[model samples]
Target chain A: MSRLAALVRGLDPRLKLGTALFLGPALWLMGLVQAGVCAVALLCIVAALASGQPLGGRMVRGLLVFVVFWVAVKAGLDAVSGMEWAQVAAGAGDLAVRLAALLLLGLSLALSASARALGLAVAWAVRPVAGGERAWKLALSLALMVHFLPMCLATVAEIRQALARRCPRCGFFLRMTVIPQAVIRALGQKTWNQTLAVAGRGLDGPQAWEPDFSWSGRDTRCALVAGGFLVWISLSLPFLS
Target chain B: MITVTDLDYVYPGGQGALDRVSLSIRPGTLVGLVGANGSGKSTLMALMAGLYTPTSGSITVDGCVNPGEGRAVRAVCRLVMQDADLQMLGATAEEDLLLGRARTDATVARARELARRFSLLPAWERPVQTLSWGMKRKVCLAAALLDDPRVLLLDEPFSGLDYPGMREMRGLLRESRAVGLTQVVSSHDLECFIDLVDQLVVLDTGRLALDGPPDAVLNHVRSHGVRPPCSWSAGQGVRSWDEESL
Candidate 1:
């Protein structure tokens, strides 16, 4: 693995997650130039984090397709609402950049940390406010979401392919309407199966374990660097605007 | 041992899946559950695994009444669903094996040993979605075995396996049986388990059609939409599909 990948992977999951959470709102609140800079930086970070992973290429491609589709839809809506062409273009571009950056931020964290580590980080972060049990439940929910999203997407794709094969000449509107219903039915069955599988393993019981997290000196240094960067961004906000 | 008394499972939509089905499974015996599509074999497995409450009836697994002592039953039972994709709860084989359990050193070592035994050690860290259908099924089986459950239920365990995969699965089941694990395997393919199973239970249209040893149940399976094993049809005694025996 590259040094950058190693460093990102070695960082405490809590720090990585905290930075991502803070950067999401910060990216949107910044001026376009600042957001653009942040987006570029996030893109590089995501690339580094995703290096050598099997799902990295597919994830990046899927995200790119979604971003393009989102931009087109936003621009078309703005145009339909009778906005000025220049304003529509600018608004759509700004939203697309920020959205891409936010997604990249999330992707970087997901690629760097295992789902269990992320769950532990979430539990640790939420424990003070939600209590240990609720925090653990929330963390489990997050982990299941992480685990099921890809399966859901795969089910959607499978339904789409089956529909296309069986109804080759179906109109666009019919395909769109049928796909969601089919996906819901398929996902419902899958969800029930997953629930049974989990129950069989006795995972539905009360949380009996506590989260154990240790911080390293490197984590402290990384947190300080992140704090200084956030301070600089906060101070520069007015001038950038 | 598992005992079912007049089990009736009706779907929420009033569709009856299993009607008046009753059977008994002896301890430390491998039972083959054979039926056509939607014949309630999977439903019966789920009920025995403590996954669902029977609409009407009682299921006892090793002295624990299901839906009454479901948690206790679940503690000693593990079910491997037909669709391995849905059964997988982790991104990788190792993670799936260690999921929902205390990940102590001993558990981790057990998980690793199971992976190695199942030939999953090479791809232990790879995403399960990237594995082939047979490999994914093996991962599910390995995960099910990680807890050392007394009762193991497999639904359509041989559906997507190739010849070699089938051989490996048969070997695994035999190994489990040898170790006194009570296993109920549901399958549409008779040849896969005809010789291996100690007893055969056939369900036809959500009702018990036949239940006995393979020799007695083999001839009647055809009337219930299941084909007799090739050797049986060829006037030969019940035979295994294993090529080594051939």
Candidate 2:
């Protein structure tokens, strides 16, 4: 809710999205030397939560899934390398930290930023890459992704509830599969309804209302802090070798 | 108010629900288009809302054939679909209406006004997944009416209204009619709209079958040995319709 509250109250929206883009990937790569990166990610998480921007509950669930996958991947890598138990444990711990750093940081960015801010930031980024309608199209797609990501998660929850309620007489293959299938069906239905309401509504080009965001002093400081961290990370990575 | 001329529509399976159906509706008139399950009543409504493009022919509103042309079809006209579930877009009824309204064009004060007019809606906004059937229908109806559209299309609208709700709906429709608003309400349930609708349009296997006044259609059906739109067997005074129709 803090994430939502901050977004509603308005911040340097462009800074929010710009922060997300670079921070997201940096966290993921930091898995190479996990501990420090995780600490950084945790800072991001704390900042995001403090913002009072409401994040989807499903996002937390997804991060948990990622954690499971990351751990499994790290364990598998250690096993394949045939490392000693001590080294393997250390490696696993490091990888886990790295994965957490990436996921938590990504989540913080997604939670703290509003769609308008995200769109504006992307537009700024894309302006040089692509011109005219193409840039806006990319921006619109990104905007849709940001707004609809939460909605899709909410939808999957409703489907799950419906699927849970389906009490088949026997645990036949069809019965077991039906529950998952019902979820797909529900999603399709929701999509169809969107198509319905959007029929005459133009899907072409950018909408009349583009997001308004300005890079403020707060933004400059945040960017500089990130730059400083990058410098430190680069300097430390050589020492690790 | 509304006119359909030689409207032809073919579904995915090549099912022709509406085939060259033509009907004219006057302003301040409540027109009822009744038909069986696959008789193309819903298809016609879809065409009217510009949700689906007709294969051929034309559907005009206040003289405009295409809804995509301008504000006539969009601003003056709106459709309330058969499935009330399709209508509830936002977490709450008020939010639902706002989402459909172009965000840039809408203001919080205007939204509040529309919500207040359909005051029953605020109660429907809960977990949204937990609203009762009638309340859901009401929420959907409220969404369609937001921004005060000039012509209303209620496809099987009176599906789950209680006695009081139905009465309230009738009052709204009458008020709309009195103000010279055009409305096309499609339903097989003729009992409730006996007085509400001025024109009757019946669809039979994708063709316009009956189009006239309620009394005239009744007389025509009786004389031709066809069943009346409503099953009135003898002199039973018009049953006051309070139950909702889907």
Candidate 3:
């Protein structure tokens, strides 16, 4: 994990996003879909390691819920319809792997990407299709959304704790009394003031859409390797299907 | 130094908060802002901190004007908000201090030093919720001072603090004053700040009622709905419960 993380820690965010974007469609096309799943899983692992994020209990629980509701439900339905156990098992395994790959990709991206870097990536991606102002606005909105997520979570947690302390015997409904107001307050004047503070710390004014990414020797080598792999997989598609 | 020249503020709903409120605070002094509830103390402090633009008139912090170049004013004068929880953007003290700022090795070291100075080193890694209100206040103060702003506007700094906590804050304010940091602390509670403040500025119904040295303003302090210190209230008062009985 350390070795994988070290490799990914300094990997350009743009390159990471591009590779993830390309990998998804490529993973869908391969006949032996496990190969694509494994590849995505590897990337997710690298991302997690690089970001130094622990695989927390909450994530495990969420994965369990997803598997039960999404993967297991389909498998059980197939079996009830008299599909063979072997086929059902195979389908379930395939779906589970694919789901895991997608989840990992998302987790890695969320963990490793900074708001500014992600904003730059989004703006750059949209610049050709959209003009610069719209691109930058969309990017800034996305960055602000990313920044607000953690703040909202913390606010909820703090409100919960405050209620608990003031009323230990407080009913769940009673405890939730402040949640709506807290959310409104957090998203309202508080968020605006925070944004002002952030801007005051030198993020104000007309921002140039200059993304700080440069192609290095390593990027070229990785690109070539990825291109060769994609070509080989596409060429071998007929045999797999 | 902060100079407010004929400052006027009106809320969006046509409610006036401050009207022609003019005052000047010199460098390296601790000034107390006293007013009743909704008396424009907080509004004036917010204006000084550059949180809100003055609807009319102006505020100059170290020669930087508000309503424009507000960021410059904020850079020189930071406000420690009344609600510590609202200002604490980080789960821990160190994280809060690092927000919106680069966390270089030097910055991290400076954060540690500030935390220690503010007696927050023990709870530096702990979640802000785990700390007492005083500790949380201290963390907010430390976070504000991380950039070493020349002026601090502390709104209700002693609210909810115990006796020892109040003493500690008084000492901290005194120490900051010694080092030439201008501070304007607004609080409805006058007892806590009376001894520490060099001058008392009283606001009554969005207007300046009195402004003078604390020793000279005890009569106006009571007139403006504030209870002066016990020493002044007991015998040297213009009117008191004892005096009224006689």
Model 3 spans with C-alpha error above 4 angstroms: A1-56, A72-93, A108-144, A154-182, A199-241, B83-112, B119-140, B158-171, B218-246
Compared with the true structure, what per-residue lDDT tens digits does model 1 show for residues B204-243? Answer: 9999999999998887899899999889999998886746
Q: How accurate is candidate 2 locally (lDDT)?
A: 0.63
Report interface Cα RMSD per prediction: 2.5, 5.3, 5.8
Model 2, residue B98: distance off in Å is 4.7
Model 3, A101-149: lDDT tens digits are 6666655665555555677688788888998778767766666676677
Error of 1 at A118 (Å): 3.2
Question: CA shift at A65, candidate 2, in angstroms?
Answer: 4.2
Cα TM-score of candidate 2: 0.71
lDDT of 1 by residue, A111-139 (tens): 88777678878888988998877887877
TM-score of the second chain in each model? 0.96, 0.83, 0.93
Ordered from best to worst TM-score, the candidate numbers read 1, 2, 3
Candidate 1 achieves a global lDDT of: 0.85
> What TM-score would candidate 1 get against the native?
0.89
Task: Return the DockQ of model 3.
Answer: 0.12
lDDT of each: 0.85, 0.63, 0.73
Tens-place lDDT digits, model 2, residues B1-246: 677778888877787778888888887788887766677877788788767777888778776675354345655677777666544534445445554235444454566665566565466334344566666666666666654666788877676777666776676677677778788888766766666778888777788778888766755534332355343545553344545331
Candidate 3, residues B180-229, lDDT tens digits: the string is 89999999987776767788899999999998887788776878888787
